[model samples]
Target: MKLIAKWVLSASALLFVAYVYNGVEVRSFATAMGAALVIGLLNAVVRPVLVVLTLPVTVLTLGLFLFVINALMFWAASALLDGFVVRSFLAALIGSLLYTAIGMVIDSALERLLVKK
Candidate 1:
């Protein structure tokens, strides 16, 4: 149930990024759903390995490197999905930033709402 909620949050964030970030657009609910799945998978698989591999840089940067990893994962998901196209590196970076920001917001909001209920 928590996992489902997490995915929904991710989907919502991706949808927002598509709307506000750049040329990226999720044409339908199905496309957004698919993009969410890919994003989750990439975060599950690629993100950990990336974090481990870049642990030194991550530590050196005072945890800021995680943002880069997050952005890379976002770009990877965009690359793997259809109907979701980031126009350039800058767009991808902004999209990635928005993805993280919105996801964090959604998660915290859900936590606040559900924990009280």
Candidate 2:
């Protein structure tokens, strides 16, 4: 149940990102959910490998390079989903940051609400 809630929250965050960025478009709520799933999977499976590979750069950049990895993952998710589109790397980066912020806030709120129950 909590997992489902988290997934829905993620999808909602993606929708918010699409809403805010002119260069990003989500065809529908369903497409946003699909995009969220792809992003979750890529983050789960691919992001760790990329993180390890780029550890030196990450260290050199003082951890800021993780944002680059996140943008790449966001763009990759867009490529995998039919109706979710990011027009450029810049758009992807902005979308990624926005999604992260939105997701963090939603997750924290949900955690607090669930904890009270």
Candidate 3:
């Protein structure tokens, strides 16, 4: 299904981040998948609430503060998962940014490919 493909794309992005950054790591494919699920859930459920609560700062910063929220969610997922490790907050921030960039690219590509089918 589309959701499964999206999850796989996210996990692939996480794996790519782990490969690119020494400070971020995943013990296995399963761990990466788990991390993807946790990150997705947090983004879906918690991120909106945090965004609403921080709307003033977000508006003040021209939406830059959303990056901080994304980093926090990434770090929280690392803390919750035993096999996924983020060595520092900076690593989490970078990883979060990379994952977003990579996921967006992959999603757009997949969307185009699926539409042509």
Candidate 4:
């Protein structure tokens, strides 16, 4: 149930990102959902490998490199999907930041809601 809720909320967050950021474009709710799933999968699978491989740079940057990884994942999702588009690397960076912020809010709300029950 929690997973389902997170997926839906993540999709909504994607839509919100598109609405607020002109550089990111999502055609519809379904496209946003698909993009969300791709982003989640990339984060779950590719992200760890990237973190490990880029450990030195990540350390050198004082953990700031993770933001670049996040942006790459976001841009990769846009590349893989048809209806979801990120205009450029800069767009991807900003969009990823907005998406991450919204996701953090969703996770926090979910944690509070579920823990109280």
Using TM-score as the measure, which candidate wins?
Answer: 4
Kindly report which residue pairs in candidate 1 clash with one another. Answer: none
Ranking by TM-score: 4, 2, 3, 1
Candidate 2 residue lDDT tens string, 31-92? 99999999999999999999999999999999999999999999999998899999999999
Clashing pairs in 3: none
Global lDDT of each model? 0.80, 0.93, 0.94, 0.98
Give TM-scores for every candidate, taking all chains together and pairing residue i with residue i: 0.85, 0.97, 0.96, 0.99
lDDT winner, 3 or 4: 4
Candidate 1 has a TM-score of 0.85
Which of the numbered candidates is closest to the native, going by highest lDDT? 4
lDDT of 2: 0.93
Among all windows of ten consecutive residues in candidate 3, which has the lowest summed lDDT? 4-13
Over 4 Å off, model 3: none
Clashing pairs in 4: none
Cα displacement (angstroms), candidate 4, residue 50, comes to 0.4
lDDT score, candidate 1, position 42: 91
